[model samples]
Target: MTVGFVMLCHTALDRAAQVARHWATHGCPVVVHVDKRVKRKGYDRLVQALGDLGNVRFSGRHACEWGTWGIVAATQEASSIMLREFPQVRHVYLASGSCLPLRPVAELVRYLDARPRVDFIESVTTEDVGWTIGGLNLERFTMRFPFSWRKHRRLFDGYVKLQRRIGLKRRIPAGIVPHLGSQWWCLTRQTLSAILDNPERAEIDRYFRRVWIPDESYFQTLVRQVSDQVESRSLTLSKFDFQGKPHIFYDDHLQILRRSDCFVARKIWPHADRLYASFLSDDPSAQATAEPNPGKIDRLFARAVERRTKGRAGLYMQSRHPNENWENGRTAAPYSVFEGFSDLFENFETWLGKATGTRVHGHLFAPDRVQFAGGDSVYNGALCDSAAMRDYNPKSFLTSLIWNTRGERQCFQFGPGDSQKLIYFMAADANAQISVISGAWAIPLFHSNRNFGDIRREAAQLQKIEAEFLTVLRASWVKARVRTWTLAEFIENPMEPLQTIVDEISPRSLRRLSEAPRLADLTGFGQFLQNLRNQGMQPVLMGDFPATGAMPQPGNRRGRPYLVK
Candidate 1:
């Protein structure tokens, strides 16, 4: 596994040369891009220092600027040079001049060899996390100003305010979801090639030219679109202070830097000669160990994982008719309801898995329908088959069993070998109320506007059905836990309800409840509620109480429904 370095540097020629020489010593090719703004003497110094390093080369200089397209342009130039000069390189790492190698270069190469397909990059949708300096706003993308805006800050600020006041904003291009991330990353050759070869490469470049801090988002957004191999985590260790500038490594931070799993650490001060000398020590043992033990950070990470997954209750949401076009009722152009749910569930499961080191299964009803966009099955033939649920290994992280409400009754039988802990999620929205009253049978006609009626009338009918259902559950002695939550609440902030549900259903002590009835053995819902109440547990309503305004009003369309098939 050949590794290449694309280092972008403007200052500290000596430090930049040291980084290049260090990596080159490990048989890695290094491509350096010195900012055009740097003095000619600085560039000459860098070249002279690295003249003996056969694997190191320099790209054409560009005037790199912070928080502008210039940084990305420099990166592209350096990466292109590396790809051309060293065609045998399998992976290219992007780093700044101040970044220092934290671990042995050989160890990093070995780690990459094992996970050849995974791209080490950090990324988040712009809408989800927003920009780093300030929260997300339209001004970042809409305002087109010169890079000199930094010099004439007041003028640029006033210009942006004026544009916003006049309602000037650029619409994000269709088929593109803006994403933002750290500028530093380690990418595979395939990912780099894909980014360079993207058909929309020119369009993307033009759009980002006016964006503030385009370097952070440009490669991140494009890489995500082109590669599913992304690991969503950067291999570089960088900590930002309150001002959002990266913390410069000092001698005091030696231990922390040495213990980190990251291959590199950033913003090393050029004047910290002692720190640099310590890092550049000739003795292998003086540097970071080849396989460093997990320190406090590892334990902290484990604790975080346990908090999210250990004993967490699974939430299963059921819809009568599943379709591809059922996202937040706004982005219904591409994804169906099933696709949207699958994506949400997959993200949730991924979060749990990463935190807990356990696999969380998503049991989607009629997998064939979801996969092929085929016809939906009314009955859940999968749930009725107990062997299928047993095979899911519920002892790990929670199982999110998604299916239509038709066969929900059969799901009561689902449990681990001896555990009876189960939580049923009931939607408290108007649409759910309508579904409960009309059942799946009337859904098609309802969607076609045939059975539509007054919102208050349908709501009242739904309340009656809910009361009756709860009454039946209370009387039946069921063993599983049941909770009511609205879709809006779940979508708005899932962590709150998820944590509550997990706390409710999780075992309170090390000792198992000997008298707890098995889920499959419970004859009615009453048995479960009674057993739960006997154990001092009460029924849970996981989300916020629905406001009266949340109730559906007359003439308000529920949502466009897609064919189940």
Candidate 2:
């Protein structure tokens, strides 16, 4: 039996064929199942977009309604069609339209050819790894979904009310042995054939009939009960959103996606076209990252300020008289010095919103700043009135980054081989909020060199983003609240390097330890500090200068935009 690609897309008719084309070009048979809910005309257009595919065939239509039995009907229909039309088709890979092929199809075929006996589906019944959001949903299971009542709106409403009354709510009931995992699966031909031919199949189908959102759980549960060879992990990268939406909208949470290194990430928005294109391209360096290219970020900086000031200049124009006599520094000092506590609080609050990730409530003089220096003042010039900022409530100072009650003593510091590198969070805002932040809820740039901020160009890119954010502030006259330690401050009030830094004090702190965690690790505080002192960054290297036989200067073209891969 040969491995075949099976695409099960609900409404994305036009997009399915993109993946089909990828598979078909490699001589792999493609089985497409367009949702029956889609219009025939749209389906026809999808077929037309497919162009000529000698090996690919549409696996009939399926009307896959969410939280309904229609999805099961579609999957079964597609599977049956696949078996009848292509008897030689072996393993069926369940994929969706949003999926993109990163590894070549030939590579996939090669991988499967190398592994014949093992099924790639993850079905371990682990409590922590992946479990159905189960509880009393089983009552929805006890009765086989009766199609006759599906259209009976009154009956459905009553059924839900009764379920809730009987304590049969949504939680997965104790010891129900609930199974769950990614809907996508790669099943062996023999297993799939057995499932198809089994006489007990009707019983299995009936059980799944009443299952809530059976599409996701049916195959996962059935596969778990059917085989022990199932791996405990799915190869597909499907994002589950908070509202039960199938797609992830990564406008603000783009950082989260970057952290999840699944081979493929998806359901990207159309607005992210540049990033989508570059990511799917054959080259990664040229990827349209959200990084602030000085040129690109600069353009946005100007445009943003323009929009803020557009048609609104009148609001500020009347404030000052153009020919008014200007005050000397002595006359201006009174206003600056006599500014009320309320004004100072307002200024801190504004900066807090822009930079700090901590929330401050009910307090005027709550000292929100934490200085990790000798006496204080990273920059003495900026500390003119900061002397009074000492003796702050420590609790208020240690609450950002979800570190409330964790105590400042419990707060750990890290260095990533550069004096300036320690200032990464400042780029996002003021104070590497993740590192130096104790209070004020806000996202500071380069928060920490720990698990966040990469030493790669990403760090530089983050700086660019924060710089861009700052430029916006400067244009709007928003004062930055946090200031860095000055050379004098470091000399007069230098604090000991954090223990995390001490652990890595060896290696003469000269050579870069591979990646991080070691004293020589670029991530270590000492190493990061050293890098800043030496004016070095995480080394970016060029790979594989394609031999002249293949191409000219191969590595150079691919070098500059250091791809994560």
Candidate 3:
């Protein structure tokens, strides 16, 4: 019953008083860890509002640097101070100033009560994504500044950019795949005690000191390593954009905030009037069910698995495809592999365009085409191939497409399935004996603002990709490839706006012909027969979408069985 909140503050002084006030009524003790670099100008008002609540407040300021270990130092200070003061507190909920409690305070307590042994921490011992515990750990442990460090963050960002281009870790150490996830976590007293008493405290600190953004990984990592069962997901509410920056909250995100079932959200801007107003205790039922908006936070988490119409997988790894093509019918050699999410594709396509000297048409499929008909956010990232299934496993996203001769996509769609039949219609053997296809490559991803950079640059990349695509199209094997489906008829459903990219970007390839029940036809392109075409594009990467119509419900996993002939 000794549950307390460890509030980490950067700015947003106005909400502190409100958050403190809410927690006080819930009878949960509070501890504040304000960033030292920033001032506590608003504390006077916040204190006055609290009016002498027993909650304790500490005054050590934490100056957190981007992608650095200062974050770990700050959290360690907070935890130590809290433990010293509240020896009786069992669970310390780590949160930020911007995050607000979405659920009634009581419901959160009950949820914790049901689970006493498990740590809400997420720690993976592997040296892969989480670099803190990896072989090249020392390069980071030493206080060696490889890149030029500058006060101006953008310049520092420039340095980071340089490192990325040259195969170096800007903030994260070299060769160490840093484990990343939500910075906020809820930990038990036992776990906290173990972390404080860790025998390798000095050694651990040595590494974290150099590691970037250690705050997000430190406590969670330590707790995860010690705890038997650490939940991979966090119970907080916060969303980061494509560049890993937290997305500012606006009224538009209200639907996500309302429907999201989380305990808290963080890194909110100072002036989120609508967001603050929405949290007011207006409705009684809203108190109990309303917690962290699961919807808002869902955007930050990436899916790890992909299952299709006939999925049968346990441990899945990405299979790198060949950068060439295979022979087919009338078409040149059919493309043996798709350049998925790779900058190399940009180079290849551009080279091919130059080689073949024609607008090289290409296609990239969706990882889970059926799942993200409306948008990527609509995806649940999990699928069940059978209707009677009990537990539907989570999966990554997949996409598909048909492109014009310019290496630009004409239409795109997604559906889920497994590796077995993924390349059945037209697939080449890739590593792990899997058939990988291009999903969502012909759309925003290939030429978007975030990862792809300036639109003009993206266009240049597209031109290059076309050049590389020529090599595929000219191959004798690819000439035999057939048409899978008409672009217009392929993605007419409201669910898949991703396919709309095709309608807008590649108009020349498909036309709504003036023939019969449906005008969508490929009669103009008489080269390939429909019989030899792939039934549909396959999702080689993320989640596998079930063909026809199938999806996993929110918090529930079930789907119609794949009709196997």
Candidate 4:
């Protein structure tokens, strides 16, 4: 797997030369793009350092500016030159002059080799809640700004305010949803070719030319349209503060950097000569060793097991009503309980299962008895009316155990057996959901608004409970040789932490679970509710039981199932 590096640089030519030499030593070709703003003397010095390297090539200079379209242009030019010059290269990594490799080049090559079709690009939808940069997504695309705005900030500020005041908004070009991410990426040759050879490339280029800070968005949005093999993570590890400026790596950060899985870390200060020397050295110790840590290796095995067992396992989930409001008569919304578990199960059998090729037979059980009560009682609460419980097919051996006060304790007997694995899933947000439900259900005379501090304290207590639950579950599972998982982790990626469990138990075959039906069939209640929405009905049966609304008839070609009375 031959890899190529495209280094974009303005200053620190000496540092860039060091990086190029290091990469070249691994038989990887380097394509350097120097900004046209570099003075002739500096340009000559850069050439003098890199000219002797047989594998290094330089692209035509562009007058690159920070956060502008010029940066995109520079990268495109360098990538184009690299692809044309070295047709044998399989993957191309985009980096900057001051960035240093975190792992050995051989290890990085192997990592890429393992996933040749995947593009290591960190991308998120532009409107994501966590992307909290002030006016960046809005102003960058909407306002027409020049590169000189940095020098004449006040003038640009006034212009932006005036544009927003007048209700001026630029429409993003057709067929593009805005995506923002780190500009650095490692892309496969197929993806690169698709990007370079796109039919609408000219239109895209013209549109982004007027966009502010297009470098971070341009390639990110466009490449995603071409390939679904994109991994929403960058191979470069970078940290930015509140203002979005990258943190400069210092000598003190060496250990932290060494531990990262990232191929590179960037924005090294020019004064760190010793640090630069360490990266440029030929000694093996200079590069982070690729030896697998025992803890990490264990986790890898668990993930492998998770991937292997997906879609074919049996899931036994036991959830208690959030303990915070147990004394209060207020109960969780019947639909919320149905929806949350439906989502959890649907994701398990459908999204996560299909994504990992594992399907699970889900059996959910919620106890009927009130907390602190000693005797058996009917579960006449919202759970009884929940579609999740009512629609479970007992004949299929799929069970939803409600109305039994001792069910949760008794269900532990149905642990992993006969080559099948059991995963226990619970929601971390159960307490918060219960709190909101209780507050909403409060009588008008007794209602009291919770302050932010109160909410924070409650949340902290809930999180502690959640953590302790996991810790105890983990210990019990370790002792019993069964697996335990959280709803949040399953929804996100269950494979991440499995390696440690796998390491400890060292199962003969990591594979667990059996082939099962599709998720659409498994989540019958969810699909029934969704069909209700499709028919323009508001299906709200909050305090009511048995979901006695008009259920769609089964075998409806539209894929809607009728609710049985």
> Candidate 1 or 3, higher lDDT?
1
Assess each prediction's global lDDT (C-alpha) against the native: 0.56, 0.44, 0.47, 0.56
On the 0 to 100 scale, the lDDT of residue 526 in model 4 is 32
| Whole-model lDDT, model 1 | 0.56
Residue ranges of candidate 1 with Cα displaced over 4 Å: 137-139, 147-149, 287-565
Residue 364 miss distance in model 3 (angstroms)? 31
Every model's Cα RMSD, please?
22.1, 24.8, 21.2, 21.6
- When 1 and 2 are scored with TM-score, the better candidate is 1
Clashes of each: 23, 38, 96, 16
Predicted candidate 3 versus true structure: per-residue lDDT over 345-456, tens digit per residue: 2333333333333232222242332322223322122432222221121122121121111143212221222121233323221111111122323333323335423433
Ranking by lDDT: 1, 4, 3, 2
For model 2, the stretches where C-alpha displacement exceeds 4 angstroms are 124-140, 143-158, 164-178, 247-265, 270-565
What would you estimate as the lDDT of candidate 4? 0.56
Candidate 2 lDDT score relative to the true structure: 0.44
